[model samples]
Target: MTNSHEKLRMMMIIALFAALIGIFSQLIIPLPLVPITGQTLAIGLAATILGARYGTYSVILYLFIGATGVPVYAQMTGGLGKLFGPTGGFLFSFVISAFIIGFILEKTRFNISMAFVANIVGMIINLTIGTIWLKLFASLTWEAAFLGGFAPFIIGGIIKAFLAAWIGILIRSRLESAKMLPKKATIS
Candidate 1:
């Protein structure tokens, strides 16, 4: 493909993953303070496949869409109000988590093992930021944040991490073989 074609393809893929994140965001398990959602899993997959720059772009696109009242967030809610709401930290953290996950894979190797580690780290980032945001935004105690935001998601986070690693590696390898993705990641 020409340089322009490659850039267009990458942009299309980024938009697709942004849409994927929105679709996954609807997969919610409701809770009191915050809900468990598949947004993180999709974020992990995007990072593992797209690398740092493109993956982060996808996340930013997702957030921007949701912030614009697209109903792309968890529970099919959107607008800046939701983006800055108590649960908004998780949404905001997706950008950082996606970048870090992709950066880790780009720095190391794009294997399942590395992906798992990256996903785990990403999960922790989400939990930490989301918990702090929940506490501050909701005016809750630290213990309440730990209980509502951090504790409830631990087991689910582990499971999602493992799944993202396994599934992401498989999809990435397949895409590389099909020439949908380059053999190695790139910044541009």
Candidate 2:
């Protein structure tokens, strides 16, 4: 493909992933400090497939939509309030985590184990930032923040990470076989 065609394809994929993130955000299991949502899973999938730059762009696009009062966040909430709210840090972490996950996948040979590890690291980053934000925003003690934000979501996070890795690798393998993945691009 020409440069323009490749750029267009990447942009389209980014938009698709951003839309998927918005849709996934609605699948929420409300909790005390934070909600369990499919957003992370979508982030992982997008990152693993789109690579670092495009993956981060996808997250940015999603955030932009949410910030514009699109009702794209959990519980159908959106706007600047949601972006600056208690769960905002976790939401923001998606950008970093997706970039990290995509970077790792692009640098390393694609495998379930590598993807699992990358996802775990990404989850840890998200949880750490989210816990700190919860404490600050809610004015809770560290223990309280851990309990409310990190503790409750540990099991679910692990499950989601594994699922993300497994599914992402599977899809990536298929795409590779079909020669749909760009060889010169960062995607792996």
Candidate 3:
């Protein structure tokens, strides 16, 4: 494809992934302070398949959509209020985690093993930032933040990490073969 066509295709894919993240966000297991959602899994998949530039773009787009009052967040909630709420840290962390996850794959190799490691690291980043934000935003103690924000998500994060690795690699390989995505990520 020509440069313009390629750029358009990439943009469309980014938008699609952003929508996917929103859809996944609705898969919520509610908790007192937070919810376990498929948002992370979708984030991992986006990073694994799209790499740093596009994956992060997708996440930003998702956040922008939600912040604009789109019901795209967990439990079908959205708006700027959600973005600044106690769980806002988790939403913000998605950008960083997606970038790092894709960056790791770009730096190493876009394979299941590497993707798994990257996803785990991304999960940790999400938990850390979310916990800290919970403490500060909610004015809770550090222990409360850790218990409510970090501890509750550990097992789910691991499962999602593994699933993202396995499924993301499979889908990415297929897309690469079909020329839907480049074998290696590029900013363009």
Give the candidates in order of TM-score, highest first: 3, 1, 2
TM match of model 1 to true structure = 0.97
Candidate 2, residue 163: the lDDT equals 89
After superposition on all C-alphas, the RMSD of every candidate to the true structure, in Å, is: 1.2, 1.5, 1.2
- Off-target runs (Cα >4 Å) in candidate 2 are none
* Residue-by-residue lDDT tens digits, candidate 2, 1-188: 78788778778878999999999988989886688999999998888777787889999999999999999988898999998888888999999999999888879867888888889989999999998998999898999999988888888888988988899889888977876667764843
Q: How do the residues 114-175 of candidate 1 rate in per-residue lDDT, one tens digit apiece?
A: 99999999999999999999999999999999999999999999999999999999998898
**Best candidate per TM-score, number?**
3
Tell me the tens digit of each residue's lDDT in model 3 across 131-180.
99999999999999999999999999999999999999999999998999
Q: Which should have the higher TM-score, number 1 or number 2?
A: 1
RMSD versus native structure for model 1: 1.2
Pairs clashing within candidate 3:
none
For model 1, the stretches where C-alpha displacement exceeds 4 angstroms are: none
Error of 2 at 34 (Å): 1.0
Deviation in angstroms for 142 in model 2? 0.6
